[model samples]
Structure formats: structure tokens, C-alpha cells
Target: MSQLERADRILDTAQDLLLRWGYRRVTIDEIAKRAGVGKGTVYLHWRTRDELFLAVGAREAVAMIEAVAAAMRADPAEIALHAYMRRFFLEAMRRPVLRALFTRDTDTLDRFLSSPARQPLQGAKLLASREYLGALADHGLLREDLRPEDLDYSLPTIAFGFFAIEPLLPKELALGLEEKADQLADVLRRTYGPARPPSPARLAAAAPEVVEIFERLAREYGAVAYGTTKGGDPEHGS
Candidate 1:
């Protein structure tokens, strides 16, 4: 197999172990064995366990970004603030590793939660950045009155609360995933969306820019996850 393909196999094994066993309990030897590679081979791809798992999270983030970007391209209305959050929330929820990363699930991530390796995962937070919010506002998809700084906090708080609170609620009282996503979308719409829907023309015009943001995020995160970026190269020096 090619070097890239072997590296991906190691990553795939690491991600599966991370999801099934959590970061604290997964080990390089086990990952190597599972991937049908020697321990040295795994180290060739990732210098340390922390770096490996961080790549796992980055990969998941790239996948989620790509999925959302694809959805936006297929339906420009998905570029609307509410629709964007809804799709993003659902995508994160559907991916267990990504869900853990989003919510900072201590049970799953343990000390890796605070490790510097967590930095690349911040790429996902770009959705809440001023540049992104400004782009949406420019298209009249976001509330005109709200500043990007205001949204930087509010957007993540509202969307993250759903993930943070779900496990705390009683199963009997808990809403189904789709129901919760719908409610979250409704709240985001009321809070951040334009007072009225943007015209179809506006949504269409916004689609390219909005989708580009996510596609850019996917490329960046993929580079880090797959060690394509300079400092991100695990094979050299992560």
C-alpha cells in the first residue's frame, strides 16, 4: 500500500478505538495491532497517542464540514442561519467522535480535552466567527441588529447547550434527536435569523460564499488530520 493509504488505515483504526474505548484507554500498541501495522508504523504516522487522537477529531471535523458544504450546495436555503445550524447540529450528533469533540465529553476524551492537540479542532468553531456571521448578515440571512461578537458567544452557547444538556435529562423527558434539532433550529431562527426570510435570490447569492467557508474548513482540517500541512506532518515532527 501507498504511504498515504497506510497512514489512513492507522487513522481509521485509531478513530474506531477512540470511539469504542475512549482516549484514556486506547494505546498505540493496540492501534498498531488493529491496523495490521507494527508499533513503529503507527508512530511513523503519529508521534504520540495524543496526536493520533487529535487527528481522529480533526478528521471527523473535516467530514462534518464537507457534509454541511455539500448540503448547502444542493440547497441554497441551507445557507440560512437557522438551516445552517440545524444541519450542523444534526451532522455532529450523528457522528459519535465529533459529538464528543463538540461537547467535550470528559468521559470519552479525558485529559485530551485540555491537551494542545485540541487546537486543530477549533477549526470547527469558525462557524461562530465574525467573518462567517458577517457573510451571513451581508446576505440578509442573519439578524441585522446582532454583531458578530455577540453571535460568537450566543451561537455556540445555544447550539452547544443542546448537546451538553441531553445526557443530563431523564430518558422519559428527553426529546428525540430530530425533535431536539428542530427545536434548536427554531430557537436559532428566532434569535439570530433575519426578521423575515431572505429572498430566494439572496440565499442563492449567499450559497457560494457560505459553502466556501465550510469547504475551506474541511481542507484545513483535513490537512491537519492527514498530516498534509507543514507543522502538522506527524511523519516528520508533529
Candidate 2:
């Protein structure tokens, strides 16, 4: 297989293993075996097991960003602040890795999520998410008065808190995730979004730049995840 195809196989295998067995139970050898490649071949893409799993996480982030971007392309209105947030939560429900990241369940694979080796990948994803929100504000899709830092802090804190804390509530009172997501979206849509939606022209104008911001982040993080850049691999000389 071509290197890119082989790398994708390794990551696909690693992600499946991660979801089936938490990070601690997963190993490079098993991932390689599942991908029908040798251990050395796995290392050819990722220098360590940590790097390999980080790549899986990176893949998940890229997939979500691409999904959002695709929606924006199809309907510029998808760039509107509330629409974006609503779609994000819906997408998160569909992607197990994203739900894991948002939940940050310490009892599960939280160790790998919090590991030092994953920082760059994590930072890139955060930067992209934050920057995209900032872009929305810049383009009149969100409240212009809102500070970027506040926008960055509040949205995730609110959405993740709902997911993290919802389980603690009485089971009888708990709503389905799609229902919860809609409620969350309504709350955020009223608070963070503009009093009135932006014009279609404004959203269309901003879509290209918003997509570029995320694409750039994906490339930078993908390089590190695949050990393609200098100092990208923690196990190797950096």
C-alpha cells in the first residue's frame, strides 16, 4: 500500500482498538497486526504508541472539522453561530472519539488524552475551534461585542459541562443526547449569537476564510501526528 494509505490503515486500526479497549490496553503490536502491517511499519508513521493514538485523536478532530466545513460549503447559513454549535454537538454524538474527549472521563482513556505527548495535537485542535468561533464573531455571525477569549472559554465549558454532568442527574429526568443537544443549542444560540442572524452574503464571504483556518490547523497537527515534521516525534531525537 502507498504510505498515505498505510498510515490511514494504521490510524483506523488504532482508533477501533481505542474505542473497543481503552488506551491502556492497546498496543502498537496489536494495531500493526490488525492493519496487516509489521510493527516497524507502524513506527514508520508514528514513533511511539502514544504518537499512534494521538494520531487517531487527530484524525477524529480533522473529521469533525471537515464535516462542519462541508456543511458550511453546502449551506452558508451553517456558518451562523447557533447553527454551527448545533451541528457540532450533533456531530459529536456521532463520533465516539469526540464524545470521549468532551466527556474527559478519567476512569476511561483520559490518561492518553491528558498525556504530555498529545499536547501539540490537542493545542492545534483547540486553536482551530477557538479561531473558528472568532471568525464567526468577526464576520457578524456572532455577537461582535463578545471577546474572543470569552467566546473560546464559555462555549466548550457549557457544552462539555452538560455532557459531563448530565449523567449525574436522576436517570428519570435525563433526556436523550439529541434532545439535550437541542436544549443546549437553544441556550447558546440565544446568549452568544447575534440578536438577528447575519445576511447570507456575510456568511458566504466568511466561509472560505473559516475553512482555511481549520485546514491550516489540520495540516500542522497532521504533520506532527504522522511524524512528518522536525521534532514531531517524541520518541525520536527532536
Number of the predicted model whose lDDT against the real structure is largest: 1
lDDT of 1 by residue, 1-238 (tens): 7777877898889888888888889999898899887777676666678888878878887888899999999999998878888888899989988888777788888888899977755756565356668888777777888777787777788888988886588868857788988998899999888888788899999789878877877887877687632233344321
Write down the RMSD of candidate 2 (Cα, Å): 4.2
lDDT of each: 0.80, 0.75
Candidate 2 backbone collisions, by pair: none
Q: How many backbone clashes does candidate 2 have?
A: 0
Question: Once superposed on the true structure, which residue ranges of model 1 sit more than 4 Å away at CA?
Answer: 121-124, 228-238
Error of 2 at 46 (Å): 0.9
Write one digit per residue (lDDT tens) for candidate 2, span 1-238: 4567777888888889888888888888898789887777777677778878778777776777778878878888887767777888878767887678777755447587678876766676677777888888778777768876786678777777776874478967857777887888888888888878778888889989887886687677667656543233333421
Candidate 2 wrong stretches, greater than 4 Å: 229-238
